[model samples]
Target: MLSRTADHLYWMSRYTERAENTARMLNVSYETSMLPQSASAATKAWQSVLSISELLPAYYQRHDEVTLEGVLHFMVRDETNSSSIYSCLQAARENARAVRGALTTEAWETQNLTWLDMNRLFKAKKFETDPAKFFEWVKYRSHLSRGVALGTMLQDDAFRFLRLGTFIERADNTARLLDVRFHAIKNDYHGTVPGKGQAQFDFYHWSAILRSVSAFEVYRKVYRNVITPERVAEMLILRRDMPRSLHASMYEVVQILEAVANDHSAETQRQAGLLLAELQYGRIDELLATGLHAYLVHFLERVHALGGRIGSDFLATADM
Candidate 1:
């Protein structure tokens, strides 16, 4: 296969995961932001999320209003927004098209249909009148796409690369979610409730996080208590068994990278191994000691930098 072919396959997987995770997160944040907020608090929450995703600057440049409508317009409807739902789905479909032969019919069809559905939704007024339903459709499609890929795709190099993309993307998103949750907890916990958000940590917010990975019931089974901010953040970020948790996703990514780069040079192996080591050995106690927000921000930076390194050495060839 050509380097470009592998690159496309890799990114096809990444973009699909990115689109799904983005929709899930935005849906949750949308609910959280809708809860009783001061005039500027919703904007502040959205800004924090956008900043964590590294999309705030792009959003600000394109939109004048920081209101819910303006930010959602930029993030949900704008074609120029790379991290937007539209752009991610479009990129995923393009890559899927480029490697149609390498992917199963189901994979291609799933992506293609989802893309079309999203386009239609954007054109319809339902998004304005029934925003919840619009987002629900996106989230539902994202889950369907993942299920088709998992059930129908082959488990070879292509599959491993695809898994690698999804795992890494999930880890990155988990970090972003944690950063937002931690900051919100810290800021709001002190206001009216001790160690809880000013407004009861909002069941809607926890449901959003749980719903992101479709793990709301799983959280209930594991914790068996009403969702609290600290536990939600912990479950989202630290739980090793949760598929969308940072630790689980990072572990999967490391294993897949090791499997794919089995013949890599010692230096490459050492770098990836070291990073994986840090992630595995980390203790939530230690992180909480230092502060979860600070740890997550730094951890995300490390993961992003590691992604750049992987691209340079393994995913893409360097000029000699």
Candidate 2:
């Protein structure tokens, strides 16, 4: 495949996954903000969403306060915010269009139509009145696009590139969500005993995290124990069976890289393999001993480095 085509295919998948993940983050924050909490706590919850999304710097430049209204607009519809759902969907559609011949008819149509529907909805200001519904629509469209590609596209280098993009984005988003939420909760409970109010707050907070990743039922089925920060981290970070787990994402990335290894350099494969190995063999106890926040920050840096290597090795072109 031409480098340009490969680049477009890879980024199209990444942008679609990013849109859905952004929705997931927003939905979790919105739901948690509705829970009983002090004003300061609520503000912290909203701020954490921006921090996890890595949008705080840009957000502060545009808005004076962290009001829900301002955050929602900045995250959902702000065209200037490159990582916003609106921008991601637009980028996805454009990338898909650039390589329409590489995509199945269903895949291309799904992406194109998603972009069109999003524009119409944004212009109608539907999200201002029903933010949850708007977010759900974004996730549904992303899933539909994925299903179309999987069900119709050929399992070839193009397909491998698409899968690579999806898993890489997924791994990054999962790590950020876990790290930010854990850090926030740890700060709130600074060695204090679980008072009735604190315990109640912790329960709801952890439940929101699980629901954000669609892992609440999986948590119940696998652990059958109370939700603690340690177990939640274990499930989301190390459990290979969990589809959105960091381990699973890394595993998928390595496997896809292997399939497409004929043309790429070995460094991309090595980075992915090392990360997957750590996730598979490393214990949660050891991770906590080193400080989970510190570990997660290191993991995120490695993931970002691997992504850059992949682009340089496989997708970078003179024109691009």
Candidate 3:
């Protein structure tokens, strides 16, 4: 495959996944913000979304304060915010258009139609009236796009690259979401004792975290008990059986890197393998003992470094 084609295919998949993940993060914040909380608490929840995406500076430059209305508009429909859902879907469509030949007819149509439908929604100001419903639409469209690609596209390097992009984005988002939510939950209980109210508080926040990743039911089935922070972290960060878990994403990353290996991709493969090993053998107890926030920060740094390696090894032309 041409380097440019590969780049487009890879980024098309990433941007689509990014749109869905952004919706997921925002949805969690939206849901929690509806609950009874202090004004400062609510503001911090909204701010965490920006922090997770590394967009705080951009957000502050545009807005004087972190109001719910301002943050929602900035995240959902702001075209200038590159990480906004609008920009991500736009980028996804542009990349898909550039490599229509590499995509199946169904996949290309799905990508194009998603963009068109999103524009219509924006024109109708759908996000302003019902942001949750707007987010659900974005997630469903992303699901449809991935399903069509997997079902219609050939299982070749192009497909591998697409899958690769999806998992890489998933892994990073999962880690960020978990880290921020867990920290908030911890802070909420800083001076509280273990009691029924604390249990209820933990349940509400932890379940919100699970639902953000679409793993609430999975948590119920896998653990078959009350939701606890340790178990929640374990399920999201270590459990290989859970589809959106870090371990599972890394497993896919390792396998896909091996499948699409090139002469220059050895270092990329090795780094991916090392990351996978850390997840595969890692225990949640140890992670929480040391500090989940610190652990996740390190993991994000490694994921960023691995992304840089992938670009240098195979997607260098993306910069051009």
Candidate 4:
């Protein structure tokens, strides 16, 4: 494939996945804020959403404070925010258009239609009163786009690139979510068992974290125990069975890269394999001992580095 086409295919999928995950983060924050928390707690939770999205700096540039309305507008509607859902979908659609022939008819139509519908929602200001519904719509459209591609597109290099984008984006998001919540609760739970109130507080926050990644039920089924910080981290970070887990995403990425391997893929493959093996063999206790925040920060850096290597190896071209 042409480097430009490969770049478009890869980024189109990444932006789509990013849009859905942004909605997931917003939904989690909105739901948690309604749980009768203190004003400071609510503000902190909202701020974490921006921080996890890596948009806190950009957000502060345009806004004075993190009000719910302001954050929602900045995250979902601000065209200037490149990582916003609006911008993600717009970029996805434009990339899809650029590589129109590389995509199946269903895939192209889904991308185009999602953009059109999003524009309508933006003009109608539908999210002002019904943000939850708006988030659901964004997630649903993303799912539709993915399903169309997986069900209709040929299982070739293009499909591999698409999957690579989805899983890389997912891995980064999952790591960020886990890291943010881990930091929030680290000091709260020293060595002592949490009191009843503290336990409930932990449960609520951890449950919200799992639900953000669609892992609440999986956590329940797999652990069948109370939601502790460590177990939540383990499930989201290391459990290969959990679809959105960091381990699962890295596993998929490694496999896809292997499938599409070329002479230039050695470094990308090596980095991906090392990351996946670390997650595959890692222990929750060891991770906690190492400082979960530090570990996660290192992981995020590695993921970012791997992304850059992949771009250089497979998608490097001036036109792209």
lDDT of 3 at 138: 94
Model 1 C-alpha lDDT per residue in residues 41-64, reported as the tens digit of each score: 677777866875788778778777
Over 20-78, each residue of candidate 4 has an lDDT whose tens digit, in order, gives 99999999888778887677767777788898988889999999988888898999999
lDDT of 4: 0.89
Candidate 1 structure, TM-score to reference: 0.88
Give per-residue CA lDDT, model 3, range 15-109, as digits (tens): 99999999988887788889887797788888888888888899999999998899888988899999999999999999999999999999999
Q: Each candidate's lDDT (Cα)? A: 0.74, 0.90, 0.88, 0.89
lDDT of 1: 0.74
Relative to the unseen true structure, what is the C-alpha lDDT of residue 38 in candidate 2, on a scale of 0 to 100?
74
Assess candidate 2 and give its TM-score to the true structure.
0.96
TM-score of every candidate relative to the true structure: 0.88, 0.96, 0.96, 0.96
Q: On a 0 to 100 scale, what is the lDDT of residue 84 in model 1? A: 81
lDDT of 3: 0.88
Question: Comparing 1 and 4 by lDDT, which wins?
Answer: 4
